[model samples]
Target: MFRDEKGFRPTQQIFTEVPPKYDILNRILTLNLDEGWRRKASATILEENPSRVLDLCCGTADLTMHLARSAKQSAELYGLDFSHTMLARAKEKVALFGEDRVKLIQGDAGNMPFEDEFFDAVGISFGFRNLTFENPDARLHISEVFRVLKPGGRFVVLETSQPNNRLIRAGYHFYQKYITAPIGGLLSGNRPAYDYLAHSAINYYSIPEISEVLLEAGFSKVSGQPYLLGATAIVTAIK
Candidate 1:
């Protein structure tokens, strides 16, 4: 693995230990809404008819597969992640799309392998938080996304968000703390990881806040679509 000052190795290790159960745990934690969210993100990306699309922080290629299933046959797709284990599982799952159709790579998000302006679109699902929340290299990660995307390209993010409704927010946080975290930890055998995930999901930014972050990173335009009463959102930014 490459050396990273942004605390990448530890995050890599956490996902490394959980990839086998990662997909299932995600479905359970979100009550099976994760699939729908990724599907929505896929549609949003394909709607633009981008020729080259990359799934940033792809993580087991769930979103990549979704993109492949929906994208035009001529579209080129790639999935990138830092965890060798996660990418291994992703490789197995994405192989059905054929190697010529979907490529998988392992690298740090803060320093990707692709050249600048290499992709027409980039989509990340449920993995954007790890690149931003309390991360010192957050700006670097986001800027890398901007660097790899073409000037008119789109960046779509499907991630957990803080709800505006006080009641819904409270219940969401409570469920994450008392139910999802413990169950996810138990099933995945990675309590520390699930603990961090729960904490981050509970404290992640609102849709507007994320839009601001993207704008600050030099995106031309940003918009969002909320789901589950704002507990989750799909934010799209134009490069």
Candidate 2:
């Protein structure tokens, strides 16, 4: 059964509860590789030269801010997340770039509150995995992404994954378990949260499986690029 199956408040609630320390713990847990991953994912949007972009799970607006600054053709950026605390920080960050170029809203990924074909591109960073387990509703999220994007829109996702190389995988597991979790717990006082992070990475589907999901979700062409020695991956699909 999924973690939320047993009367747990939604993941949004969990994020709200932990919002105070979420960014700090995230930086510590990834040793700041998290930012680099977002950078790589945002590059895909740049390639598409999208004028309007949607960033799902735009926690703290890190990627949203990056896109606003970097994408030469990106004139408007919309960030959506369920947690108000996360959105609050994101709003503050977006302000640094001027409110006219960026907007932040509180919304669910599986059920985005946006119109069909409203955006030129969509990007998700470390957010899809939190939508649901084995994500039965994943297609809903993808469908919404597809629906909100104009024809020929690009959808890009950056997520954690198991490395194929045995040696690197083993080392990655060790770091996640011993080094990442302990530090995360110390910083956030939420050992279980960090444990959940590690477990999700271990139990989530392989890149190929995720690519299949994207295709089933109605994306025309799906491709994945592995990064950080395959500890993380970015999947790009066209609507």
Candidate with maximal TM-score:
1
lDDT of 1 by residue, 1-239 (tens): 22235645345557776556778878888899989999999999888899999999888899999999999999899999888888889888888978788989999999999999999999999889989988889999999999999999999999999899899999999998999779977887766677777888888999999999999999978999999999999999999
lDDT of 2 by residue, 132-202 (tens): 44566766777888889898999888887778999999898888878876776667665666666666776
Worst 10 residues of 2 by lDDT: 1-10
Highest lDDT against the true fold, candidate = 1
The runs of at least 3 residues in candidate 2 whose Cα sits more than 4 Å from the true structure, single-residue gaps closed, are 2-6, 9-13
Q: What lDDT score belongs to each candidate, Candidate 1 first?
A: 0.88, 0.79
Error of 1 at 29 (Å): 0.8
